[model samples]
Target: MSADPNPHPTEPDVRPHVYDGIREFNNRLPNWWLFTLYATIVFWVGYWAYYEWFRVEPEGARSVELAMTRIDAAKLAATAAVNIDDKSLWAMSRNPVFVDAGRQTFEANCVACHLKSLRGKSESPTAIGPDLTDQIWIHGGDPTDLYRTVTQGVPAKGMPTWGPVLGPKRITEAVAYVLSHHKEGEPIVIDTSVSAPAK
Candidate 1:
Protein backbone atom coordinates (compact mmCIF):
# COMPACT_ATOMS: atom_id res chain seq x y z
CA MET A 1 0.00 0.00 0.00
CA SER A 2 1.46 3.41 -1.03
CA ALA A 3 1.47 6.07 1.70
CA ASP A 4 -1.16 8.79 1.29
CA PRO A 5 0.45 11.65 -0.72
CA ASN A 6 -1.70 14.28 1.10
CA PRO A 7 -0.48 13.96 4.67
CA HIS A 8 -1.66 16.69 7.09
CA PRO A 9 1.18 19.05 7.98
CA THR A 10 2.00 19.01 11.67
CA GLU A 11 -0.51 21.30 13.42
CA PRO A 12 1.07 24.42 14.90
CA ASP A 13 1.01 24.44 18.71
CA VAL A 14 -2.01 26.47 19.92
CA ARG A 15 -1.97 25.75 23.62
CA PRO A 16 -4.00 28.35 25.50
CA HIS A 17 -2.13 29.90 28.39
CA VAL A 18 -4.15 31.22 31.37
CA TYR A 19 -2.65 33.71 33.84
CA ASP A 20 -5.62 35.18 35.79
CA GLY A 21 -7.57 34.96 32.47
CA ILE A 22 -5.47 37.68 30.70
CA ARG A 23 -4.09 36.42 27.36
CA GLU A 24 -1.62 37.73 24.75
CA PHE A 25 -1.75 36.64 21.12
CA ASN A 26 1.64 35.80 19.50
CA ASN A 27 1.20 37.10 15.92
CA ARG A 28 3.79 38.42 13.45
CA LEU A 29 3.50 41.96 12.10
CA PRO A 30 1.58 42.35 8.77
CA ASN A 31 3.77 42.31 5.60
CA TRP A 32 2.78 45.89 4.67
CA TRP A 33 3.54 47.29 8.12
CA LEU A 34 6.86 45.41 8.40
CA PHE A 35 7.92 46.69 4.96
CA THR A 36 7.07 50.27 5.91
CA LEU A 37 9.11 50.01 9.11
CA TYR A 38 12.11 48.60 7.20
CA ALA A 39 11.87 51.43 4.60
CA THR A 40 11.88 54.10 7.32
CA ILE A 41 15.00 52.57 8.94
CA VAL A 42 16.77 52.46 5.57
CA PHE A 43 15.95 56.12 4.86
CA TRP A 44 17.30 57.23 8.25
CA VAL A 45 20.58 55.32 7.67
CA GLY A 46 20.99 56.85 4.21
CA TYR A 47 20.41 60.41 5.47
CA TRP A 48 22.88 59.97 8.35
CA ALA A 49 25.54 58.62 5.98
CA TYR A 50 25.02 61.44 3.46
CA TYR A 51 25.04 64.46 5.85
CA GLU A 52 26.68 63.71 9.20
CA TRP A 53 28.99 60.75 8.47
CA PHE A 54 30.24 62.04 5.11
CA ARG A 55 33.28 64.36 5.08
CA VAL A 56 33.35 66.92 2.25
CA GLU A 57 35.12 70.32 2.35
CA PRO A 58 32.54 73.02 1.59
CA GLU A 59 32.95 74.73 -1.78
CA GLY A 60 33.75 78.51 -1.99
CA ALA A 61 34.71 78.62 1.69
CA ARG A 62 37.90 80.61 1.11
CA SER A 63 36.41 83.17 -1.29
CA VAL A 64 33.30 83.70 0.81
CA GLU A 65 35.36 84.32 3.97
CA LEU A 66 37.60 86.85 2.19
CA ALA A 67 34.63 88.74 0.73
CA MET A 68 32.99 89.05 4.19
CA THR A 69 36.19 90.57 5.64
CA ARG A 70 36.45 93.14 2.85
CA ILE A 71 32.80 94.14 3.26
CA ASP A 72 33.28 94.78 7.00
CA ALA A 73 36.38 96.96 6.38
CA ALA A 74 34.58 99.01 3.74
CA LYS A 75 31.65 99.69 6.08
CA LEU A 76 33.96 100.79 8.89
CA ALA A 77 35.93 103.07 6.53
CA ALA A 78 32.76 104.78 5.27
CA THR A 79 31.59 105.60 8.81
CA ALA A 80 35.07 106.87 9.86
CA ALA A 81 35.32 109.12 6.80
CA VAL A 82 31.99 110.74 7.54
CA ASN A 83 32.99 111.41 11.17
CA ILE A 84 36.34 112.97 10.20
CA ASP A 85 34.79 115.23 7.54
CA ASP A 86 32.09 116.41 9.92
CA LYS A 87 34.67 117.35 12.59
CA SER A 88 37.03 119.27 10.32
CA LEU A 89 37.97 122.89 11.33
CA TRP A 90 36.50 124.47 8.20
CA ALA A 91 33.29 122.50 8.61
CA MET A 92 32.95 123.53 12.25
CA SER A 93 33.34 127.31 11.71
CA ARG A 94 32.64 128.47 8.13
CA ASN A 95 30.26 125.63 7.29
CA PRO A 96 27.74 126.62 10.02
CA VAL A 97 26.44 123.09 9.68
CA PHE A 98 28.47 121.71 12.60
CA VAL A 99 27.76 124.49 15.09
CA ASP A 100 25.34 122.23 16.88
CA ALA A 101 27.99 119.55 17.00
CA GLY A 102 30.45 122.02 18.47
CA ARG A 103 27.85 123.12 21.00
CA GLN A 104 27.17 119.53 21.96
CA THR A 105 30.86 118.89 22.46
CA PHE A 106 31.17 121.96 24.65
CA GLU A 107 28.22 120.88 26.78
CA ALA A 108 29.75 117.44 27.33
CA ASN A 109 33.36 118.38 28.05
CA CYS A 110 33.26 121.92 29.45
CA VAL A 111 29.90 122.21 31.22
CA ALA A 112 31.02 120.56 34.43
CA CYS A 113 33.87 123.05 35.05
CA HIS A 114 32.70 126.04 33.00
CA LEU A 115 29.00 125.67 33.91
CA LYS A 116 26.26 124.63 31.47
CA SER A 117 25.37 128.22 30.67
CA LEU A 118 29.08 129.15 30.21
CA ARG A 119 28.84 131.16 33.46
CA GLY A 120 31.76 130.82 35.85
CA LYS A 121 31.10 129.13 39.21
CA SER A 122 29.70 131.74 41.50
CA GLU A 123 29.64 129.88 44.83
CA SER A 124 33.23 128.68 45.06
CA PRO A 125 35.54 130.59 42.70
CA THR A 126 38.67 129.04 41.25
CA ALA A 127 41.51 131.55 41.64
CA ILE A 128 43.82 129.67 39.30
CA GLY A 129 41.31 129.64 36.41
CA PRO A 130 39.82 132.78 34.90
CA ASP A 131 36.08 133.43 34.91
CA LEU A 132 35.03 132.48 31.36
CA THR A 133 32.14 134.96 30.84
CA ASP A 134 34.24 138.02 31.71
CA GLN A 135 35.58 140.40 29.03
CA ILE A 136 38.68 140.70 31.19
CA TRP A 137 41.24 138.57 29.42
CA ILE A 138 43.44 136.01 31.11
CA HIS A 139 44.57 134.50 27.82
CA GLY A 140 44.58 136.86 24.81
CA GLY A 141 41.05 137.58 23.51
CA ASP A 142 42.01 136.51 19.94
CA PRO A 143 40.63 133.30 18.43
CA THR A 144 44.14 131.91 17.79
CA ASP A 145 45.13 132.52 21.41
CA LEU A 146 41.89 130.98 22.64
CA TYR A 147 42.50 127.94 20.44
CA ARG A 148 46.02 127.61 21.79
CA THR A 149 44.72 127.86 25.36
CA VAL A 150 42.22 125.04 24.79
CA THR A 151 44.70 122.81 23.00
CA GLN A 152 47.80 123.38 25.12
CA GLY A 153 45.88 124.06 28.35
CA VAL A 154 46.97 126.26 31.24
CA PRO A 155 48.74 123.75 33.42
CA ALA A 156 49.63 126.48 35.93
CA LYS A 157 45.92 127.17 36.29
CA GLY A 158 44.95 123.47 36.49
CA MET A 159 43.40 123.29 33.00
CA PRO A 160 43.71 119.88 31.35
CA THR A 161 45.63 119.24 28.16
CA TRP A 162 42.65 119.10 25.76
CA GLY A 163 44.74 118.85 22.57
CA PRO A 164 45.27 115.09 22.64
CA VAL A 165 41.68 114.51 23.74
CA LEU A 166 39.66 117.01 21.65
CA GLY A 167 41.87 117.14 18.49
CA PRO A 168 42.60 120.36 16.51
CA LYS A 169 39.21 121.05 14.96
CA ARG A 170 37.32 120.43 18.19
CA ILE A 171 39.75 122.60 20.10
CA THR A 172 39.12 125.50 17.71
CA GLU A 173 35.37 125.21 18.02
CA ALA A 174 35.42 124.98 21.79
CA VAL A 175 37.62 128.09 21.98
CA ALA A 176 35.46 130.06 19.59
CA TYR A 177 32.35 129.15 21.49
CA VAL A 178 33.91 130.21 24.80
CA LEU A 179 35.02 133.56 23.33
CA SER A 180 31.56 134.14 21.94
CA HIS A 181 30.11 133.46 25.37
CA HIS A 182 32.21 136.23 26.97
CA LYS A 183 30.93 138.81 24.49
CA GLU A 184 27.27 137.88 25.11
CA GLY A 185 26.86 140.97 27.42
CA GLU A 186 27.74 139.39 30.75
CA PRO A 187 31.03 140.32 32.45
CA ILE A 188 31.84 138.08 35.39
CA VAL A 189 33.59 139.67 38.37
CA ILE A 190 36.29 137.89 40.33
CA ASP A 191 38.57 138.54 43.37
CA THR A 192 41.83 138.86 41.35
CA SER A 193 42.60 139.18 37.62
CA VAL A 194 45.66 138.07 35.61
CA SER A 195 46.61 138.94 32.02
CA ALA A 196 46.56 136.08 29.48
CA PRO A 197 49.86 135.08 27.86
CA ALA A 198 50.45 135.64 24.12
CA LYS A 199 50.18 132.60 21.87
Candidate 2:
Protein backbone atom coordinates (compact mmCIF):
# COMPACT_ATOMS: atom_id res chain seq x y z
CA MET A 1 0.00 0.00 0.00
CA SER A 2 1.34 3.55 -0.87
CA ALA A 3 1.42 6.23 1.88
CA ASP A 4 -0.79 9.35 1.34
CA PRO A 5 1.19 12.44 0.17
CA ASN A 6 -0.85 14.80 2.39
CA PRO A 7 -1.12 13.16 5.85
CA HIS A 8 -3.44 15.89 7.14
CA PRO A 9 -5.00 18.05 4.39
CA THR A 10 -6.30 20.65 6.90
CA GLU A 11 -2.98 21.11 8.77
CA PRO A 12 -0.23 23.57 7.81
CA ASP A 13 2.37 22.43 5.25
CA VAL A 14 5.77 21.01 6.43
CA ARG A 15 9.09 22.65 5.52
CA PRO A 16 11.01 21.24 2.55
CA HIS A 17 14.18 20.70 4.65
CA VAL A 18 14.42 17.50 6.72
CA TYR A 19 16.97 16.67 9.47
CA ASP A 20 17.58 12.96 9.93
CA GLY A 21 14.01 11.48 9.83
CA ILE A 22 12.22 14.58 11.24
CA ARG A 23 10.57 17.44 9.28
CA GLU A 24 9.66 20.89 10.77
CA PHE A 25 6.16 22.33 10.39
CA ASN A 26 6.17 25.82 8.78
CA ASN A 27 3.60 27.36 11.17
CA ARG A 28 3.51 31.02 12.36
CA LEU A 29 3.70 31.55 16.13
CA PRO A 30 0.55 32.86 17.83
CA ASN A 31 0.36 36.65 18.08
CA TRP A 32 0.14 36.57 21.89
CA TRP A 33 3.39 34.57 22.26
CA LEU A 34 5.25 36.78 19.74
CA PHE A 35 4.02 39.90 21.48
CA THR A 36 5.19 38.62 24.90
CA LEU A 37 8.70 37.80 23.57
CA TYR A 38 9.03 41.22 21.89
CA ALA A 39 7.77 42.96 25.00
CA THR A 40 10.33 41.12 27.21
CA ILE A 41 13.19 42.17 24.89
CA VAL A 42 12.11 45.79 24.94
CA PHE A 43 11.75 45.78 28.72
CA TRP A 44 15.23 44.28 29.15
CA VAL A 45 16.79 46.93 26.88
CA GLY A 46 15.07 49.76 28.79
CA TYR A 47 16.03 48.31 32.18
CA TRP A 48 19.69 47.93 31.13
CA ALA A 49 19.84 51.49 29.85
CA TYR A 50 18.17 52.93 32.95
CA TYR A 51 20.30 51.07 35.49
CA GLU A 52 23.58 50.12 33.78
CA TRP A 53 24.43 52.46 30.87
CA PHE A 54 22.60 55.73 31.47
CA ARG A 55 22.45 55.25 35.32
CA VAL A 56 19.13 57.11 35.52
CA GLU A 57 18.32 55.05 38.63
CA PRO A 58 20.58 53.66 41.33
CA GLU A 59 21.45 49.96 40.99
CA GLY A 60 21.64 47.48 43.90
CA ALA A 61 25.20 48.44 45.00
CA ARG A 62 24.62 52.16 44.66
CA SER A 63 21.34 51.94 46.59
CA VAL A 64 23.08 50.07 49.44
CA GLU A 65 25.88 52.68 49.57
CA LEU A 66 23.40 55.53 49.72
CA ALA A 67 21.48 53.82 52.53
CA MET A 68 24.73 53.30 54.48
CA THR A 69 25.66 56.98 54.13
CA ARG A 70 22.29 58.04 55.51
CA ILE A 71 22.57 55.61 58.42
CA ASP A 72 26.06 56.90 59.29
CA ALA A 73 24.84 60.48 59.26
CA ALA A 74 21.91 59.62 61.52
CA LYS A 75 24.20 57.83 63.94
CA LEU A 76 26.58 60.80 64.08
CA ALA A 77 23.70 63.15 64.74
CA ALA A 78 22.34 60.99 67.55
CA THR A 79 25.79 60.71 69.14
CA ALA A 80 26.28 64.47 68.94
CA ALA A 81 22.90 65.15 70.60
CA VAL A 82 23.95 63.29 73.75
CA ASN A 83 26.20 65.04 76.31
CA ILE A 84 29.39 62.98 76.72
CA ASP A 85 31.70 63.92 79.59
CA ASP A 86 33.62 62.36 82.53
CA LYS A 87 30.43 61.91 84.62
CA SER A 88 28.50 60.49 81.68
CA LEU A 89 31.30 58.08 80.80
CA TRP A 90 31.55 57.01 84.45
CA ALA A 91 27.80 56.34 84.47
CA MET A 92 28.08 54.29 81.27
CA SER A 93 30.85 52.22 82.82
CA ARG A 94 28.50 51.33 85.67
CA ASN A 95 25.78 50.22 83.29
CA PRO A 96 26.10 46.52 82.44
CA VAL A 97 24.42 46.96 79.04
CA PHE A 98 26.93 49.50 77.80
CA VAL A 99 29.88 47.60 79.26
CA ASP A 100 28.74 44.32 77.72
CA ALA A 101 28.41 45.85 74.26
CA GLY A 102 31.76 47.56 74.74
CA ARG A 103 33.33 44.25 75.73
CA GLN A 104 32.09 42.62 72.55
CA THR A 105 33.44 45.46 70.42
CA PHE A 106 36.73 45.50 72.29
CA GLU A 107 37.22 41.74 72.04
CA ALA A 108 36.48 41.74 68.33
CA ASN A 109 38.82 44.63 67.42
CA CYS A 110 41.24 45.21 70.33
CA VAL A 111 42.29 41.69 71.33
CA ALA A 112 45.06 41.61 68.72
CA CYS A 113 47.07 44.35 70.41
CA HIS A 114 45.61 44.64 73.93
CA LEU A 115 45.09 40.89 74.58
CA LYS A 116 41.89 39.23 75.81
CA SER A 117 42.52 40.25 79.45
CA LEU A 118 43.08 43.91 78.37
CA ARG A 119 46.27 43.91 80.51
CA GLY A 120 48.39 44.45 77.41
CA LYS A 121 52.10 45.04 78.26
CA SER A 122 51.51 44.32 81.94
CA GLU A 123 50.35 40.77 81.26
CA SER A 124 52.93 40.02 78.58
CA PRO A 125 56.21 41.78 77.77
CA THR A 126 55.71 41.30 74.04
CA ALA A 127 52.25 42.92 73.95
CA ILE A 128 52.14 45.95 71.65
CA GLY A 129 49.47 48.00 73.46
CA PRO A 130 49.81 49.52 76.93
CA ASP A 131 48.12 48.04 79.99
CA LEU A 132 44.50 49.16 80.10
CA THR A 133 43.85 47.83 83.63
CA ASP A 134 46.75 49.72 85.25
CA GLN A 135 46.13 52.98 87.06
CA ILE A 136 49.19 54.44 85.34
CA TRP A 137 48.24 56.18 82.10
CA ILE A 138 50.79 57.34 79.54
CA HIS A 139 48.37 59.80 77.98
CA GLY A 140 45.87 61.04 80.59
CA GLY A 141 44.04 59.30 83.47
CA ASP A 142 40.70 61.11 83.45
CA PRO A 143 37.58 59.49 81.95
CA THR A 144 37.27 62.26 79.35
CA ASP A 145 40.98 61.93 78.64
CA LEU A 146 40.58 58.22 77.94
CA TYR A 147 37.73 58.94 75.55
CA ARG A 148 39.77 61.58 73.78
CA THR A 149 42.79 59.27 73.55
CA VAL A 150 40.72 56.43 72.12
CA THR A 151 39.05 58.75 69.60
CA GLN A 152 42.10 60.77 68.51
CA GLY A 153 44.62 57.92 69.02
CA VAL A 154 48.36 58.27 69.70
CA PRO A 155 49.76 58.02 66.20
CA ALA A 156 53.32 58.42 67.47
CA LYS A 157 52.73 55.44 69.78
CA GLY A 158 51.44 53.33 66.83
CA MET A 159 47.76 53.57 67.82
CA PRO A 160 45.47 54.02 64.84
CA THR A 161 42.59 56.51 65.18
CA TRP A 162 39.49 54.43 65.99
CA GLY A 163 36.95 57.32 65.83
CA PRO A 164 36.39 57.01 62.06
CA VAL A 165 36.50 53.23 62.06
CA LEU A 166 34.27 52.43 65.08
CA GLY A 167 32.16 55.59 65.09
CA PRO A 168 31.40 57.69 68.20
CA LYS A 169 28.89 55.26 69.76
CA ARG A 170 31.12 52.19 69.63
CA ILE A 171 34.14 54.18 70.79
CA THR A 172 32.15 55.48 73.74
CA GLU A 173 31.04 51.95 74.54
CA ALA A 174 34.65 50.71 74.36
CA VAL A 175 35.77 53.50 76.69
CA ALA A 176 33.04 52.50 79.09
CA TYR A 177 34.25 48.91 78.98
CA VAL A 178 37.81 49.99 79.83
CA LEU A 179 36.53 52.25 82.62
CA SER A 180 34.52 49.41 84.15
CA HIS A 181 37.82 48.05 85.52
CA HIS A 182 38.46 51.17 87.59
CA LYS A 183 36.66 53.23 90.24
CA GLU A 184 35.60 56.85 89.69
CA GLY A 185 37.61 58.33 92.60
CA GLU A 186 40.67 56.14 92.22
CA PRO A 187 44.08 57.83 92.12
CA ILE A 188 45.30 58.40 88.55
CA VAL A 189 49.05 58.00 88.24
CA ILE A 190 50.50 59.47 85.04
CA ASP A 191 53.54 57.58 83.78
CA THR A 192 56.10 60.29 82.96
CA SER A 193 58.83 57.69 82.30
CA VAL A 194 57.42 56.76 78.91
CA SER A 195 56.96 59.74 76.59
CA ALA A 196 55.43 59.82 73.10
CA PRO A 197 57.61 57.98 70.60
CA ALA A 198 59.89 60.39 68.72
CA LYS A 199 58.28 61.53 65.48
Candidate 3:
Protein backbone atom coordinates (compact mmCIF):
# COMPACT_ATOMS: atom_id res chain seq x y z
CA MET A 1 0.00 0.00 0.00
CA SER A 2 1.40 3.52 -0.88
CA ALA A 3 1.78 5.95 2.11
CA ASP A 4 -0.16 9.25 2.04
CA PRO A 5 2.17 12.04 0.83
CA ASN A 6 0.02 14.84 2.42
CA PRO A 7 -0.13 13.99 6.18
CA HIS A 8 -0.87 16.98 8.51
CA PRO A 9 2.00 17.43 10.99
CA THR A 10 -0.22 19.14 13.74
CA GLU A 11 -2.42 15.98 14.07
CA PRO A 12 -2.00 13.78 17.24
CA ASP A 13 0.83 11.22 17.23
CA VAL A 14 -1.46 8.79 19.21
CA ARG A 15 -1.63 5.49 17.30
CA PRO A 16 -4.97 4.51 15.73
CA HIS A 17 -6.62 1.45 17.25
CA VAL A 18 -7.34 -1.30 14.67
CA TYR A 19 -9.97 -4.05 14.85
CA ASP A 20 -10.63 -6.41 11.93
CA GLY A 21 -8.51 -4.14 9.59
CA ILE A 22 -10.66 -1.05 10.58
CA ARG A 23 -8.72 1.93 12.05
CA GLU A 24 -10.33 4.32 14.58
CA PHE A 25 -8.53 7.73 14.92
CA ASN A 26 -7.90 8.93 18.51
CA ASN A 27 -9.31 12.44 17.78
CA ARG A 28 -10.64 15.03 20.33
CA LEU A 29 -14.48 15.26 20.46
CA PRO A 30 -16.17 18.41 18.94
CA ASN A 31 -16.23 21.49 21.22
CA TRP A 32 -20.07 21.61 21.33
CA TRP A 33 -20.34 17.97 22.43
CA LEU A 34 -17.65 18.40 25.12
CA PHE A 35 -19.32 21.63 26.33
CA THR A 36 -22.69 19.85 26.59
CA LEU A 37 -21.16 16.96 28.60
CA TYR A 38 -19.46 19.42 31.01
CA ALA A 39 -22.67 21.49 31.30
CA THR A 40 -24.73 18.41 32.25
CA ILE A 41 -22.23 17.35 34.94
CA VAL A 42 -22.19 20.91 36.42
CA PHE A 43 -26.03 21.08 36.24
CA TRP A 44 -26.36 17.76 38.12
CA VAL A 45 -24.01 18.95 40.92
CA GLY A 46 -25.86 22.30 41.28
CA TYR A 47 -29.26 20.55 41.27
CA TRP A 48 -28.14 18.14 44.02
CA ALA A 49 -26.86 21.02 46.20
CA TYR A 50 -29.95 23.25 45.67
CA TYR A 51 -32.53 20.55 46.47
CA GLU A 52 -30.81 18.35 49.09
CA TRP A 53 -28.75 20.95 51.01
CA PHE A 54 -30.73 24.21 50.65
CA ARG A 55 -34.38 23.24 51.26
CA VAL A 56 -36.84 25.91 52.48
CA GLU A 57 -40.11 25.19 54.30
CA PRO A 58 -43.85 26.01 53.83
CA GLU A 59 -43.04 28.73 51.25
CA GLY A 60 -40.52 26.97 49.01
CA ALA A 61 -41.09 23.74 47.02
CA ARG A 62 -42.81 21.43 49.48
CA SER A 63 -41.23 18.25 50.84
CA VAL A 64 -43.27 15.05 51.01
CA GLU A 65 -44.37 15.67 54.65
CA LEU A 66 -45.23 19.34 53.95
CA ALA A 67 -47.17 18.34 50.83
CA MET A 68 -49.10 15.76 52.83
CA THR A 69 -49.88 18.32 55.56
CA ARG A 70 -51.14 20.79 52.97
CA ILE A 71 -53.30 18.06 51.39
CA ASP A 72 -54.76 17.17 54.80
CA ALA A 73 -55.38 20.85 55.53
CA ALA A 74 -57.20 21.17 52.21
CA LYS A 75 -59.36 18.16 53.10
CA LEU A 76 -60.24 19.66 56.48
CA ALA A 77 -61.03 23.02 54.88
CA ALA A 78 -63.27 21.37 52.30
CA THR A 79 -65.13 19.38 54.95
CA ALA A 80 -65.59 22.51 57.07
CA ALA A 81 -66.66 24.68 54.11
CA VAL A 82 -69.33 22.30 52.82
CA ASN A 83 -72.33 21.86 55.13
CA ILE A 84 -74.75 19.02 54.27
CA ASP A 85 -77.87 18.40 56.30
CA ASP A 86 -81.56 17.37 55.96
CA LYS A 87 -82.44 20.76 54.47
CA SER A 88 -79.60 20.45 51.97
CA LEU A 89 -80.75 16.93 51.04
CA TRP A 90 -84.30 18.20 50.58
CA ALA A 91 -82.99 21.16 48.57
CA MET A 92 -80.87 18.83 46.42
CA SER A 93 -83.91 16.64 45.59
CA ARG A 94 -85.33 19.42 43.39
CA ASN A 95 -82.15 19.50 41.26
CA PRO A 96 -82.30 17.12 38.26
CA VAL A 97 -78.47 16.81 38.14
CA PHE A 98 -78.24 15.79 41.81
CA VAL A 99 -81.13 13.38 41.35
CA ASP A 100 -79.43 11.81 38.34
CA ALA A 101 -76.13 11.52 40.22
CA GLY A 102 -77.98 9.92 43.12
CA ARG A 103 -79.71 7.47 40.80
CA GLN A 104 -76.38 6.56 39.20
CA THR A 105 -74.72 6.18 42.61
CA PHE A 106 -77.59 3.96 43.77
CA GLU A 107 -77.49 1.87 40.61
CA ALA A 108 -73.71 1.42 41.04
CA ASN A 109 -73.50 0.98 44.81
CA CYS A 110 -76.90 0.10 46.30
CA VAL A 111 -78.30 -2.18 43.53
CA ALA A 112 -76.71 -5.22 45.15
CA CYS A 113 -78.97 -4.86 48.23
CA HIS A 114 -81.64 -2.27 47.28
CA LEU A 115 -82.08 -3.60 43.69
CA LYS A 116 -82.74 -1.80 40.39
CA SER A 117 -86.29 -0.49 41.00
CA LEU A 118 -85.23 1.02 44.37
CA ARG A 119 -87.43 -1.58 45.97
CA GLY A 120 -86.03 -4.91 47.29
CA LYS A 121 -83.61 -7.09 45.29
CA SER A 122 -84.92 -8.30 41.92
CA GLU A 123 -84.43 -11.94 42.98
CA SER A 124 -85.71 -11.98 46.61
CA PRO A 125 -87.92 -8.89 46.81
CA THR A 126 -88.98 -8.85 50.46
CA ALA A 127 -86.13 -10.93 51.93
CA ILE A 128 -83.06 -8.70 51.38
CA GLY A 129 -84.27 -5.08 51.78
CA PRO A 130 -87.51 -3.07 52.08
CA ASP A 131 -89.36 -1.43 49.18
CA LEU A 132 -88.11 2.18 48.85
CA THR A 133 -91.02 3.11 46.53
CA ASP A 134 -93.37 2.59 49.48
CA GLN A 135 -93.71 5.63 51.77
CA ILE A 136 -93.30 3.42 54.85
CA TRP A 137 -89.84 3.50 56.49
CA ILE A 138 -88.75 1.41 59.50
CA HIS A 139 -86.48 4.34 60.44
CA GLY A 140 -89.07 7.20 60.55
CA GLY A 141 -90.36 8.72 57.31
CA ASP A 142 -88.37 12.01 57.48
CA PRO A 143 -85.44 13.25 55.40
CA THR A 144 -83.27 13.46 58.53
CA ASP A 145 -84.23 9.92 59.52
CA LEU A 146 -83.40 8.64 56.05
CA TYR A 147 -80.06 10.47 56.09
CA ARG A 148 -79.15 9.03 59.49
CA THR A 149 -80.22 5.53 58.46
CA VAL A 150 -78.20 5.70 55.24
CA THR A 151 -75.02 7.41 56.54
CA GLN A 152 -74.82 5.53 59.82
CA GLY A 153 -76.20 2.15 58.81
CA VAL A 154 -77.83 -0.31 61.21
CA PRO A 155 -75.05 -2.85 61.89
CA ALA A 156 -77.39 -4.94 64.09
CA LYS A 157 -79.62 -5.14 61.05
CA GLY A 158 -77.85 -5.96 57.74
CA MET A 159 -77.55 -2.39 56.40
CA PRO A 160 -74.03 -0.95 55.86
CA THR A 161 -72.83 2.58 56.74
CA TRP A 162 -72.75 4.12 53.27
CA GLY A 163 -71.72 7.64 54.40
CA PRO A 164 -68.03 6.71 54.70
CA VAL A 165 -68.19 4.35 51.73
CA LEU A 166 -69.73 7.02 49.50
CA GLY A 167 -68.67 10.56 50.51
CA PRO A 168 -71.00 13.16 52.12
CA LYS A 169 -71.90 14.81 48.80
CA ARG A 170 -72.75 11.40 47.33
CA ILE A 171 -74.76 10.47 50.45
CA THR A 172 -76.70 13.75 50.10
CA GLU A 173 -77.47 12.97 46.48
CA ALA A 174 -78.45 9.40 47.35
CA VAL A 175 -80.79 10.61 50.10
CA ALA A 176 -82.36 13.08 47.70
CA TYR A 177 -82.87 10.37 45.09
CA VAL A 178 -84.42 8.03 47.65
CA LEU A 179 -86.69 10.79 49.02
CA SER A 180 -87.76 11.71 45.49
CA HIS A 181 -89.67 8.41 45.42
CA HIS A 182 -91.55 9.22 48.65
CA LYS A 183 -95.18 10.24 48.26
CA GLU A 184 -96.53 11.90 51.39
CA GLY A 185 -99.69 10.34 52.93
CA GLU A 186 -99.17 7.29 50.68
CA PRO A 187 -100.53 4.28 52.54
CA ILE A 188 -98.52 1.01 52.47
CA VAL A 189 -99.41 -2.18 54.35
CA ILE A 190 -96.98 -5.09 54.83
CA ASP A 191 -98.25 -8.67 55.05
CA THR A 192 -99.12 -9.82 58.59
CA SER A 193 -98.36 -13.41 57.52
CA VAL A 194 -94.56 -13.14 58.03
CA SER A 195 -92.50 -10.52 59.98
CA ALA A 196 -89.59 -10.00 57.58
CA PRO A 197 -86.23 -8.66 58.80
CA ALA A 198 -85.82 -4.83 58.89
CA LYS A 199 -83.98 -3.34 55.86
Best-performing candidate as measured by TM-score: 2
Steric collisions counted per model: 1, 0, 0
The residue pairs found clashing in candidate 2 are none
- State the C-alpha lDDT per candidate: 0.62, 0.90, 0.74
Give the runs in model 1 whose Cα sits over 4 Å from its true position: 1-96, 122-129, 182-199
lDDT of 1 by residue, 74-147 (tens): 87775455332223433345434455566777898987677766665543476334456666566655455566
Winning candidate number (lDDT): 2
TM-score head-to-head 2 vs 3, winner:
2
Cα lDDT over the full model 2:
0.90
- Model 3's alpha-carbon lDDT is 0.74
TM-score of 2: 0.61
Q: How far is candidate 2 from the true structure (C-alpha RMSD, Å)?
A: 7.5
**Tens-digit lDDT string for candidate 2 (92-160):** 999999999999999999989999999998999999998999899989989888888888998888788
lDDT at position 187, candidate 1: 52
